[model samples]
Target: MSDSMVPRKPPSKGFAKKKKNIILLSMLAPGAIWLILLRYLPMFGIVIAFQKFTIYTKNPTLLNNIIHSDWVGFKNFGFLFTTSDSWKMIRNTVGYNALWIVLGTVIAVSFAIMLSLLTKKFVAKAYQTLMFFPYFLSWVVASYFLMAFLDPTYGLINHLQKQWGIEATQWYFVSKPWPILLTVAYLWKNIGYSTVLYLAAITGIDTSQYEAASIDGANKKQQIRYITIPHLKTMIIILFIMSVGRIVNSDFGLFYQVPQNNGPLFPATQVLDTYVYRAFMATNNPGMSTAASLLQNVVGFFCVITANSIVRRIDEESSLF
Candidate 1:
């Protein structure tokens, strides 16, 4: 029997599947490497949260500085609670987050529904583009734009006030309106993103359900109540849980840059992130900043777990495990 007379066996399905899986894994390699390096590897430095974390020229290396730092137990954590501004910052952070969660969900869902109802596709796209542009603008740039509008002497707002026979108010110097301003700013920049999410979910729904409802004499509101809301209930719960997890993590740029770090606005605008930044800047302490960040993430993690557990109890299919 010559070799040429032997028949070649076909590749097995398991082998083909393994090859396909290898290709898919190869495609994911870059992102996996990036995640490991930038995210998980940094977890090793978390010990800095409990140390004095001093730097020196003896070794002049990151690992050396971390290894040489002295442990101070819970001293760094005390900085968050012992200050006079602690209560205020915590209150502002939680209050703004809670309010934004409510407003963001309501406004985003409403806007998404309205956009979905638009008969014209281009008009809906135009509106989405207009709303989404603000989300991309950095807080630094946003602050400059805000300054242009709120500057007492030359701002467009003051200019309009003069035209309307009203007193030109110095906006940054005032604290009373800051909570409202910050809320509006957050929604203006963020609502579009959430709206798009909900809109995508809405588009995935079967048009026949709506059509059937319409034929059954159900009105637009009734259809939304019966079909749409029930379909979106999962997404709403997921987003709500995610938002709750981030309740302790304030946006540093929004609190710090947007208000130009004004002194008077601290009463209304100060948050844990801004407080950590100020403390680190004043004391040049890495431990305090690291501790605060660690605390925020720990709290956020627990919040996510607790929310997911509650959801699992109510609806296992919709729960985010």
Candidate 2:
């Protein structure tokens, strides 16, 4: 046969697979574009962290500010460590985060396990809804709700205390009591969300494993200790790794709005986040804020890496990486 009359071979299996993968990948394009626009693009402003960023009086665009600003290098970073309140801020931030991470995990996991034990589907759903409701409420709105119960005079707690002939506490102004108050607020607002996540993971577990354990004369506690918990090990490790990554960050609204920003409460609630906000507001310095934010992100990034490495070293199968 002549070259012009040669027949072409059919598409190979790999070629068909590649075509199918391309179509599937196209489905992710929208999410990829959104991330690039909102997350990745803004990372270009990280340069402002090194600059003493000030708007040019003649041409004050953000780009112009970045170009005209003086390079202060590590000086902006030094501000975080050099301030008199630096130790206090760092302590509060790390301490609160540590407490939340440990307590939140224990409480969320325990609650999730309890919720999974609910035999009635309707009751389980109702409990989930109640737990999840606070996650939807904005911090601004939640602050008002907290104020209603904690108000010194007419607040529900104070009113009850008065009725019982107890002293009324000015909750917002008392720094000593805020540790407990903030802990409660943090858990109340956060635990439900975490519980719902673990509950979902628990729901995926094979019920037959539990049935088998039960037939072997294992009690409910024993079943949970072995079958239920072992199945949840991977999920728990992943969540812990994610939580570890954010160890340097705090919920700004919880520290600020929950106590209504009373000066007296600053001793207990002046975390890095709130401190940075206060510093930026006091000096109107973008460079300072940018440096603080960059520091947090870098620390968080390393934290995640370190946590994953530790988990991988112990149990390769459970590591997030």
Candidate 3:
């Protein structure tokens, strides 16, 4: 046999590397397009916030010629902050979001922990499906459902009160009960996703660790406290850190639509998102909405930075960075 006739490996065909590149590019293309169209492209509109936008103006440049449309740097932001509604919106946003984070984490973690303990796969799957169903519903749909139960006249709550010989209550227009209602609605709608996330994290834990804990005569609660929670610490910290970013942004539909936009509920229901919507409605200023959104992003960025720093200080492993 001639040495020249011997077969060689043919340089791996470089298929693996080429395939990886193709896969990465494919994955990135959709997201890149989405960000450009929906997220990044709209950033050009930020200039509107600086300009005195008017409907009569065909374009900002043309309006600048007819009117003294000069840059009012920080003036809109100043108006936002100086208004009486500013403090109220900020307070409502922070309060509701804080409550949501704490309660949501607790309920989701507890549900996930309980689910992990269930031996029956079918039962667990059924529970998960039922929980997830609500998450799929749009806020508009959920608002209608909420109103059916809470409406002042024909609502179930009012009907029940009447049946019990009590005066039927007007709840939709009231500010007092909204904090609790909003929190409950948020939990009901959001718990499924968080539960699924925590469950996935739990499943990733090594079974050998649990067996060893069992051998050590650890009770279920002890196993959970020592093993499960410690394993989840990093995920918990990461999710909480993410939640901090949205502390200023409320669930707009929940605050706006659920209360049916009745003015009486403004004190309790108004948050930065809803307040911005109302402002935009009155003045037809997209700039104010943009400004509000930009402010939210700025605050969220600082909050995330601060939160991650604190997390890193306490536990470097748990820090998102």
Candidate 4:
């Protein structure tokens, strides 16, 4: 065939560029609007942190609040830094989040591996559906479920204890055992979602690798160690990096609700979020809440950056940024 007879047409570069821009804009508009409305707009309220904000003040105006309100430069932050509970809040937030990261990864990765091994399609689907059902339930609802099991006077544990002729323990008021309980609770409530993610990652992996490993005399555990773990490394690092950002942030609902906000457990369970809530309620101090929120955001931002840096040093390709 003659080259001229092929009738090749030149690509419309400008048209393609315009089409690409239009598609990009269309895809981004909704998220951009949502971020502006939900995330950025409320950031204006952060001024309340630097000001002595009194909700009951008669003059109901942002300008008045900014002007008349005393400018306590870094005083609120000072309180966060210097207060006795400050260290505790920091410790609890970081501690729990760190625990969550480790335990969550272990359970999720392990469960995903087991889930990947299941050959029965129907059973796998059913099991995954069952495991994922709890993710749909709100933390508030889950809190009630937790209370039913852990309630001091009349709870599932107490009832079971009675049946076994043993004394029921007051779990709510008990703080010493809370770290373990909270960790397990966090894992139980959250692992399914992570497991699903990891399972998806596992499924994305080529099966030929497993078959090849088997032919090479790699046992199940060895196959997993050599191929599966190596393949999942990227996903794990990505997840770990993402989790580090929230290291300074606690699950408000999980800590607040599951514990039923029992005062006695405050020492053990009082995270930055719950502490902020209490401070907000006691004095109705918007400043404290704002300060806490700002601190969390700042700390989270720094933590993510630091984590990404670490990840980059270890594996540049897997680093989020």
Candidate 5:
């Protein structure tokens, strides 16, 4: 065929564009559907917070119940705040979470920095694997493991006490030691995950900074303080801001199961989550539970906003938003 008369292939711009769009949509489909179903869809149920919800009615469908239920403005919330245990629940919840956020950050960051500085890769990986083992453990399993140490008659603690000629203590019945115990448990379960995060951040740091610091005669401590810590500050602040959002929400299993639901330890252990669970189980009033949940969400939302605002003011780069 003559050179000018040869057939040329059609352009593929449109087909390529369409194929790219399809691939993007396919990749996003699962996550988009998940968010719609699990996150956005449940937001509609927040209306039930204001309604006195009943599970069994002549018409038991969700829409029917929502429409038929009586609206009680803020009364459900008032119920949560009016009881004598209200202050106790708030105190325990906020107190324990505040402690966890602070201690968890410090311990996790310290561990990550130390681990990253390890001379041997195999030793560091082994230690990391051992530490991370607890993060996968269910809180129920962790509670039983804790019981093995705190069990009144035959626990390791009591066994040691007996060996030392000290009287065996009823650990579950006592509230004094629980704050420490719960903090320990929280650290043990969570430190591994947080360490992994911080360690990942640490690994991303530019090694040139350390090399320059070394050239400047900065010691390990000096280099860490000036370089490594500054590099991690952003991640630390971001995580702290997120943690603040959950300040009102207690770990239900940690507060409920860890103490074995001992009534005597309620003063130390009962937080907003456990309180709401107990109240719902006792009264079957979804309204009150929903109100509590709604309040927590609202508070958490504001907390994130406030934390981000504060971070923005101090260090704009570190703000979550």
Candidate 6:
């Protein structure tokens, strides 16, 4: 047909809207599917926490198996609380995380501020690279690195002590110093990542704020107090809230591998995760293990909610929700 001989048709609004909706849905599909598969689907296993689950089930379906399993009300949870080590583990977990949150925030923010103050980009990059290197190392590898310095007989610290005519101390068997050692190790591994996060936030701050402060005759510390810190407040609060959520969780490797699972160090190093792992391994009790995990998750959920609520009351815009 010749041009203009045929009637021109307009685009349908309904089809256009449908096409746009399809594109939006397509963009959201992967994340939605991932959430369903990894998060929502696994939640079904929470029932196992309340059930006396067995491996010898004849049922082919998971739901059927759960239906057949004996339901024990809160016995599994009660078992965890009745143990002598329960309070100890809970104390260690919360204590270590509390210290970590405080120290990590301070150190990360300080390092980030230092990084922001650097005029030489290359020097700053080098320092940042060095700081971040330890974070990439696995806990197993980090443990060995620690052992090299801490091992009593032929370790570097012992060798140095020998040269200095001081007695070599057995580190792994000693519980007294482990709290400090573990805290240091945790800080060494985590500070880099935290610094990176804070640095990004700092970098996002308006340079004009600092310039204005400088024009007002503010010194470096004054500029930091008046301008930098106020800008970082939101990021700080968000990070703090997230950390609070994981108060019940601990670095299994840090508590386990780094200490080499030494019985003597259990007093200082045995956090909730490590305790649960050892208990589950020794007893082969899925119900107890699942119950422990469920408790941790529930506590963590409430912690996040509580932290967010507090922040919302103080500054609604800064709250995660």
Report the C-alpha lDDT of model 6 over 1-321, residue by residue, as the tens digit.
Answer: 899899888889999999999999999999999999999999989999998876645755777777778999778887778889889989999999999999999999999999989999999999999999999999999999999998898699999999999988899998999999999999999899999999998988888988888998999999999888998999999999999999999999999999999999999999988888888899888888999999999999999999999999989999999
Which digits, one per residue and each the tens of the lDDT, describe model 3 over residues 1-321? Answer: 898989886656588789889999999999899989999876777776776666445555644532555567777676588787888888989998998899999999999999999999999999999988899988899998987898778789998999999987789666898888888888889999999999999999999999999999999999999999999999999999999999988888888777888899899988989888888899886667877888899999999999999999988989999
Q: Which 10 consecutive residues of model 2 have the lowest summed lDDT?
A: 135-144
Residue 57 lDDT in candidate 4? 78
lDDT of 5 by residue, 1-321 (tens): 799999899869999899999999999999999999999998989988988986647879998888888898888898788889999999999999999999999999999999999999999999999999999998899999999998988799999999999999999988989999999999999899999999999999999989998998999999889998999999999999999999999889889888999999998899999999999999999999999999998999999999999999998988999
Measured on C-alpha atoms, candidate 1 has an lDDT of: 0.93
Weakest lDDT window of 10 consecutive positions for candidate 5: 50-59
RMSD of each: 1.4, 3.0, 3.2, 4.0, 2.0, 1.9
Clashing pairs in 2: none
TM-score preference between candidates 4 and 5, better one: 5
| Top TM-score model | 1
Candidate 4 Cα lDDT to native: 0.86
| Model 2 lDDT tens row, 1-321 | 898889989999999999999999899899999999999999999998898888899989888888999999888898899889899989999998989999998999999999999999999999999988998887888888999999987799999999999999888888998888889988988999999989988989988988888899999999889977888889889999999888999999999998899999899989999998999999998888999999999999999999999999999999998
Q: State the C-alpha lDDT per candidate.
A: 0.93, 0.91, 0.87, 0.86, 0.93, 0.92
Q: State every prediction's TM-score relative to the real structure.
A: 0.96, 0.94, 0.90, 0.90, 0.95, 0.94
Arranged by lDDT with the best first, the candidates are: 1, 5, 6, 2, 3, 4
lDDT at 65 for candidate 4? 71
lDDT assessment of candidate 6? 0.92
Instruction: Please identify which of the two predictions, 1 or 6, would achieve the higher lDDT against the true structure.
Output: 1
Residue pairs with clashing backbones, model 3: none
Query: Given candidate 3, what's the lDDT at residue 62?
Result: 41
Please report how far candidate 1 places residue 283 from its true position, in Å: 0.3
lDDT of 4 by residue, 1-321 (tens): 988789877879998999999999999999999999999998888888887775437876876676677778777766667768878788898988988899899989999999888899998898788888888887899888877888867788888998999988989878888888888777777889999999999999899999998998999999889988898999999899889888888889888988888888877898988888887888787887898889888988998899999889988998888
List candidate 2 segments past 4 Å from native.
1-15
- Per-residue C-alpha lDDT of model 1 across residues 1-321, encoded as one tens digit per residue: 999999999999999999999999999999999999999999998899999998867977999998889999989899999999889989999999999999999999999999999999999999999988899999999888888989988899999999999999989999999998899889988999999999999999999999999999999999889998899999999999999999999999999999999998899999999989989999999999999999999999999999999999999989977
